[model samples]
Target: MAIKNVVVAGGSGALGTPIVNELVKSGFNVTVLSREGSTTTQPAGTTVKHVDYKSVDSLKAAIAGQDAVVSVLGSFAIPEQIPLAQAAFAPGSTIKRFIPSEFGVNTRKTPGSAIGKILGAKTQLVDFLTEEANKNPNFKWTGISNGHFFDWGLSRGLFGLDREKRTAKIYDSGNERFQASNLPFVAKAVSAVLQKADTPDDKTANQYFEIASFTPTQNEVLAAAEELTGGDKWTVNRVSSAEVQKVAEDKLSKGDYSVFVDLLSVWQYADGAGHAPNLADPALGNNILGLGHQDVKESVAAWLKE
Candidate 1:
């Protein structure tokens, strides 16, 4: 099936915007379903549709006739999986494929650790889609596990680095390497997956697709930054994984969900302990996606320029 038309829920947000832009650049007709009165700009050749997440009918109408739906919508209060499933399986709908807001770790396989607790809600979303796919043969879903957001984390200071201060607090030896993907790389992966929606033999349904750039350690990232900046102007501090996990557990015990989630992400890959099992898929990792090791120094240089 040729997926020419795509609908992106929460397309106005930070991550979704890039995905939508990439899809548009790839010649896919894109539509963005956002909250009513949303002021976010839509990429050229993409339409913005107003649809409330809570309204099944609104969502169904917005998703109608689309070959694929890419959802990056998230809310701390609500699990969006239900609405997404509803829209995909709406009565007489033609939606063939669905990509949930799974842009982090492999929550479905690893659900007991700190990352598990933080991403437990996302697991529920995945389970919802699993059941839906069982009930509807035409319904299929893909989960993108890209380890960490490489460029965004550095530029926006997401991984605890003060971009202005050029300082980062490291965990463990900072020598553990894990795969990371830039936001644009993530967007390209989504576009590739949508482009080949009919190849069910690929076993993409209810399956996790691991997408990554070069797997590098925290020390490596810091070194790249230093090399790019031409000095040791950045300060790197060390923290134990056990200490970070303890703090995450404490926050969860205190009902601070936001801090708990952040800590969970820290515990998942702080020491590069978590491995992407699905990177072995040649179709996803090599042939089809053609994802290769990206230069950290070059990536950081581009980010610093921006």
Candidate 2:
């Protein structure tokens, strides 16, 4: 029940790197599960095992002695988690905890919505986790939903704000509040979850621990950016969330996956797309996870400097 040895899949990715680093800093025995021939170098103070994700037996063997498994697999490989989960729950398997990549939206409970459609693979894996956990009482799963990636996404121009250009695509009057988290903060939250699970009761098991640096509207972010870089230097273009949704849906029909970001915009900033449902419940452990608040100004400052 005490989680000391942890194995992380996709340990070289954007999100996985931070989680692995934080786990190392937290003094957990870390193992990274890479593909059969990954040439990527892993972080220091961690072990690496090359295994075929296609082979459940290989994955099970690689993670045989791990106390917990944390998955940071990309969206395209989301279905790959099902076999990994099965391997974890196999007879004689020692893995007690499984953390799937639920970092973005809360898609486990919204399979019927538009953003759900965009992130259907996440729902599929969640369903598999649910069934597996029900079959084995000792096996538990944890999800960390922090809405959107504020720092990473903003740096990559995914948050509608171009850090270099000083321009923003303000969606729908720029007043829709939503959840957001920085990379390091969410990484620390992962460490907190594992520490909480390193106990007899394990309160973090089978739960989606929601945490955020801060939740801010698009306009609020713009104001912060303007204050950092002067209002006159920044250009703003108001966009309709409904219109973006329409375009995203059309692209989805054509198998254009890039429209997924636009679909998320529909849910995050639109009027009736159920934005930030996790924030509705304050009882959820944000502070309990040792996650502290960060202002939008700080986020803007970081992104602008990046």
- Judging by TM-score against the true structure, name the best candidate: 2
User: Would you list the C-alpha lDDT of every candidate in the order shown?
Assistant: 0.75, 0.82
Cα lDDT of model 1 by residue, 1-306, tens digit: 467889998787767888998998889999888788778778778888998788788888888888888888765523765786788887698888889888866566668765566677788888888888898898888888776788877777766566567788777887766667888888888887887776654555667777786667777777777777767668877788777778768878777766754664464456657663344567554345555556777887887788
Off by over 4 Å in 2: 231-233, 272-274, 277-282
How would you encode candidate 2's per-residue C-alpha lDDT over 254-296 as one tens digit per residue?
Answer: 8788887888876777754455544435545576665667777
Number of the top-ranking candidate, with lDDT as the measure: 2
Count of clashing residue pairs in every prediction: 0, 0
Off by over 4 Å in 1: 75-78, 162-166, 199-203, 231-234, 260-265, 276-288
Q: What TM-score would you give candidate 2 relative to the actual structure?
A: 0.94
